[model samples]
Target: MEREKIKRIVSKHRHEKAAILAILHEIQEEDKQLETESLNYIAQLLKIPVANVYGLATFYSAFSLGKKGDTKIRVCSGISCHINGADEVNEALKSKFNLEMGETTWDEKFSLEKVHCLGLCSIGPNVAFNLVTYPKLNKERIETIIEILHKRTGDSK
Candidate 1:
C-alpha cells in the first residue's frame, strides 16, 4: 500500500488510546496483511519501538505478517471434532489444495489452518470456510465444499 495511506491511517489514531491496535487493524483492512516496512514506518511515526509494533502483529492471530490467500480454511481440531474425523477432513483439504497447515496455496487462492474449536461439538469435524462453518464433515462432504470453493474462485481445479 502507499506510504501516504498508511501515514494517514496512523495519523488518524496517533492521539487515541491503544492507537497501535487501531492502526494495525486499518492497515490489515486495507492491505489484507501487514508488511514489515509499513510496521517500521508506523513505529517510527509513533515514536515507539519497532519490536513493539512487530510484536503486536505477531501476537494476534487476526494479524497476518505476509500476504494471505483469498480464501482461508480453518479446520477444527477440538477433542470432539478430532474424535469425529477432523484429521481425515484436514487430510482431504491438504490433498486437494496441496497445502499443509499454516500454509497458503501457490496460487494464493486458499490457505489452510487448524484451529481449536468452533463451539459446536455435536457437529463434529467442523470446518470454517472463510466465515461460514461446515459441520459433520467427511471426505465426500469436504470434496463438494472444495468444488464450490474452487468454482467461486474461478479455478477449474
Candidate 2:
C-alpha cells in the first residue's frame, strides 16, 4: 500500500488509541504484516514517533513484521498428537505445500507452524487453521483443506 494511503488511514485515528489499533488491525488483516513502510507512514501521519508503531507491533503476536499468509496452519506436536502421527501429517502438509515449518509460502496461501496443542488430544494428529481444528488428519486431507481455505478467502494460492 502507498505511504500516503497509510498516512491518511492513520491520520483518521487522531487521539483515539483504540482507533489507531483498529486501523493497524485492518491493515494487517489485509496485508498480514505491518511493514516498516506502514509503520513509518502511520508515525508520520499520526504525529507519533516511528518507535511507537514499531513498539506496538512488537508487543502483539497478532502483528507480524515478517511474512504472513492468508491462512495460518498450526499442527499439533504434543505427545498425544505425536503418537497419533502428527509428524506424518506435518510432513504431508510440508511436502504437499512445499513449505518449511514457521514459514509462509511465496503465494501467501498458507503459513505452517507446530503449535504446542490445540487441547483436543483425543483427536490426535490434529491440524488447525485459524483455530478450526481437524483431527486424525492425513495426506489426503491437505488438498481439500487448502482448497476450503482458499475458497473462503477467495485466494487461488
Candidate 3:
C-alpha cells in the first residue's frame, strides 16, 4: 500500500483515537491484506506502538497478513450449516479448486476458507464469495457459483 493512500485514510478519520479499527479496515479493503509496511506506517501515523497495530490486525479475522486472491470464498461451518451438509460443500469446493481451507490458488484467483457462520441459518450451508452470500449450498450449486466467478474474473478454467 502506498503511504499517500494510508495518509489519506488516516486523514479521513483525522487520526482520531477511536478510528483505529476503521482505518485498518479501509486499508485492508483497499489492499486485500495488510502489508507490513502499511502496518508500520499506520502505527507511525496513529502514534501507537507497531506491536499494538500488529496485534489488532492479527486478532481480527477480517485482516490478513498474507496476500489474498482476487476472489475470496468463505464456507460457513456453523452447526446449522454443518448439519445441512457444509462438509460436503467444502469437500466439493476443495476438489474443484484443489484448495484446502485458508489456502489461495497458485493463480491468485481464488481463496477458500471456512468461517464459523455467515448469520443466515434459515438457508444453511451458506457460502460467501467476495462479500456476496449464497444460501442453500450443494456441490452442484457451488459449481455454478464457481463457474460464474470464473467467468466474471476472466478465468477460462
lDDT of 2: 0.77
Q: How many residue pairs clash (N, CA or C atoms closer than 3 angstroms) in each of the candidate models, in the order given?
A: 0, 0, 0
By lDDT, the best candidate is 3
Ranking by lDDT: 3, 1, 2
lDDT of 3 by residue, 1-67 (tens): 9999999999999998589999989988788789999999999998999999999999988888876
Candidate 2: pairs in clash: none
Question: Would you list the C-alpha lDDT of every candidate in the order shown?
Answer: 0.84, 0.77, 0.88
Candidate 2 or 3, higher lDDT? 3
Query: How does residue 19 of candidate 2 score in lDDT?
Result: 78
Q: Looking at model 2, which ten-residue stretch has the lowest summed lDDT?
A: 9-18
Better candidate by lDDT, 1 or 3? 3
Mark the regions of model 3 whose C-alpha exceeds 4 Å error after superposition. Answer: none
lDDT score for candidate 3 against the true structure? 0.88
lDDT for 41 in candidate 1 is 86
Predicted structure 2: clash tally: 0
What's the TM-score of each model vs. the native?
0.86, 0.65, 0.92
Clashing pairs in 1: none
In model 2, which runs have C-alpha deviations exceeding 4 angstroms?
Answer: 3-15, 18-22, 78-83, 119-121, 130-132, 143-157
Cα deviation at 147, candidate 3, in Å, is 2.6
